[model samples]
Target: MAIQKNVLRVADLPQKKPTQFDIQPEAAQLDQITDQLELSALRKVRFKGVVAPIGQRDWELTAHLGATVVQPCVVTLAPVTTRIEEDISRLYLRELPEISEGSEIEMNTDDTVEALPATLNLDDILIEALALALPLYPKADDAALTQAAFTKPGEKAMTDDDARPFAGLASLRDKLNKDSDGSA
Candidate 1:
């Protein structure tokens, strides 16, 4: 059976009770999440969490999320595998803070707090959290950028330092000083 994306209904949540959820995305769902995250590949994704009411209209949600992903190395373009684990927490409010056009909304930035919608979409949250946890630059353990051997048709290959414009500036300065001394 295909996994349902959104499962939690905030309205039906019992007062003073905590609800637990454990979700493991199937192959198809993992593919969808991988596409959404723009990852090279996703081997697995799992989330285990609990949601409990804290106040009359407020709730606290906490989850332990884990995922295995594959990304391209930034320098070598090789596939790099990564395992991600995160302890996620959020506070849901029944009433969202009002904001008008061109108005500033004040919010507490310390915690992941948001307005509670009619239903909570765990799939969406899982995708978002995984994307955030992914490394911006992934590189294989042994991948390193060696000196380039790129050269135009007949030109000699240039080393990395040779490609820099100022690499020979000190030598030029020394030759100029020697020439000046000889002329004197």
Candidate 2:
């Protein structure tokens, strides 16, 4: 079925049939998404999924998200392009456990469960999935950090070897043995 609107009311859905939906944002929408995500560019973003009723008063959303995105390299600032594909699932329950503000409580181990909302926003779901799938650090193929050394003029610089206390003691013992042998 053609999903004309981005938002759908949960109560209006068919009781026994699954609703298929596809989301392919326009150029302007893509630009907004790129700006929101801080991505250099986004192309060919698509979300295809089905929403079906579970047991009484529960619903499940299963979807596949695919997109091509470009991001700045973490080290060299070069553009790194990535193709992302993810399988997303969410369970909406009519009755969700409540948590008080500022209260320390054990988190539910199931991350896919959510309180049932009067309306489901597909755009929000797509954005959230994309954000979660993005790479924490992007790097170009030739990006590498070079080692640097610094020391004050006329002062000895501490190297990795000099940082070892045991190594310094061993060198001191060898020097003492050599001096004694020469004196004898």
Candidate 3:
């Protein structure tokens, strides 16, 4: 079925019957994730899969979503590649008979409200993608080099500690020595 940019309703979906639907997250959905996730630059991210409408009373819904994400490294501030595979499932119940029958949906006019049906909202699926794509520590290819410099032995390594930051300290020591010996 052709995917839409915003909310999806049972009537809008393509399927043999209203009993089930398959939800696939498209590239357009990534906008929702990048806007809120902050950490994910979202070089390119997309979700693809299906949401099936299933329930004894024909009121239950399940949506499976998968995505691939490319984010930037947090430490080196370089680009990093991340592969994300996820399946998101949501269960839905209708608050009113009209929305349940695919008649119409009403939300708080001023705020963002999550509306569900025997239908899947693309925005929610994007959120699931971001959650799965996130890394505990985002590392670029040069992350290894950054780590090695810090862990190396003291004498052989040139890191923050061994740099010229202390050149002034050495000069101060020399002046103190001269003053104590009356050589100033």
Candidate 4:
């Protein structure tokens, strides 16, 4: 069966067949998402996918997410627009691997595997995937970081070259060598 609602109960689904789903947020929903994500704008977004039973108990969801987002440039604060298209895969397992308490366990290699939930909320998955796919530091095409120095009025401002710990030592060594050669 095709699904459109935001939430789906696993027990209510047909156990033998894959269920297709498509989600497109309305304008108000988009605005809520934009605010929730701290985005300047979320003009469009869509998620379409299929959930299928794996074996007798487990399930898997595979989806494609597309979005047009706007965020401030990290350096210049100008609006930076980005088009995002991502494919997402998640496996719902009836039983997750065991990790004993107080034991140092290596991180699981597969991040997509998750414990099966009684009900799956499509909106939560869509928001999570969108959040993960967004660029951490969005930059406009012409945005650049310019350097500036700050100091007290009477004090010399420190530049990048001067900030190096050994920079002054090199000039001091050169002067010392010149003096020794002249004395010799």
Candidate 5:
């Protein structure tokens, strides 16, 4: 879901150039995260964003960010440190109509602009960048070894169960198919 209120409006923020940002307290705890599923992870986040004005209703935001995501070993549940780096760009538009919700809305990509604000929220930009940095599946090397240890040596692999329980369906279908083919 979109972080509804968290995104700072372009008009509301200053149009100043992008600058480096370092968030404390919030970031300082990053190393403390050890796979607490029910809790927000601690993370050190750093990012830089540059805004280029396009037209009256648009701007191009380019950003790069880095974070350390404390993931767990898939097998042993040990804390695994994962480093992430991301480069993101977005075309910010004002007053987007619901009918044109598709990404077809044209934007001036050629670095043209009517104006920019003096400054903007750096946290929102970093949050967005970090969100993208989240990995689909995180695992540690030990986790792989743990799973490998669960298998039996030289054991036969089990077959996946067929979802349709009627094992005779294939034979019956073959008979019917033969009848139909013969008639044709």
Candidate 6:
């Protein structure tokens, strides 16, 4: 899926100074994005970022991103709205080191570094950031699971003790105590 609504050409980046950009997708774009992400709705999305050149060919992109989204609750299926705000950063490299066939590819743990493409797609980054910020299991404010006694047709309802394997031990102990008291 081509999610590149906003594309910045590599040739347009400033070499000596950082260039800043503000991103706010249109309503249609937002609809497309929500459909792509499987969200119920996307109310708003805003991003402000700077792209600065690092050495000769490397660059870095930093942004403050915010969004309002609605998703279905995991349990009740009600719409759960959420506001997300985060700071995201990515490093662009001109060339990535080659890896051997069998060797493990060790990556940087803190910062994400990727190869610089001909054009940078800010929308793609926005989608990724929003996806990461979303709650894995969302719940509504008043949503809850209710417990009720379950019984089969023409059968009595089972109590909590009926679910335990050792419930009969307590009755046996009580009967033994009563018999010993009577004999004494």
Per-model TM-score, in order, reads: 0.75, 0.78, 0.45, 0.91, 0.51, 0.76
Candidate lDDT scores, in order, read: 0.86, 0.92, 0.54, 0.93, 0.54, 0.89
Poorly placed runs, candidate 2 (over 4 Å): 1-5, 98-106, 149-184
- Candidate 3: deviation at residue 131, Å? 3.1
TM-score quality measure for candidate 5: 0.51
lDDT by residue (58-177, candidate 5, tens digit) is 677777676667765556677767788888676555544354565675665653222334335555556545655676566666555411223367975433333356656887999999
lDDT preference between candidates 2 and 3, better one:
2
lDDT of predicted model 2: 0.92
Model 4 stretches astray by more than 4 angstroms: 1-5, 102-104
Q: Which candidate number has the best TM-score?
A: 4
The TM-score measured for candidate 6 stands at 0.76
**Candidate 6: 10-residue stretch with minimal lDDT:** 1-10
For model 1, the stretches where C-alpha displacement exceeds 4 angstroms are 1-3, 95-108, 149-151, 156-159, 162-184
Best by lDDT: 4
Misplaced by over 4 Å in model 6 are: 1-3, 104-107, 147-184
Q: After superposition, how far is residue 14 of candidate 4 from its true place, in Å?
A: 1.4
Per residue, candidate 2 scores C-alpha lDDT tens digits across 3-89 of: 235897999999899999999999888888899899999999999999999987989999999999999999989999999999999
Residue by residue across 72-126, what tens digits does model 4's lDDT show? 9999999999999999999999999899999999998999999999998898899
Worst 10 residues of 3 by lDDT: 56-65
Point out where model 3 deviates above 4 Å: 1-4, 10-32, 39-46, 56-64, 93-119, 144-184
After TM-score superposition, the amount by which residue 40's alpha carbon in candidate 6 deviates from its true location, in angstroms, is 1.4
| Window of ten residues with lowest summed lDDT in model 4 | 1-10
Q: In model 2, what lDDT does residue 133 have?
A: 98
For candidate 1, the clash count comes to: 0
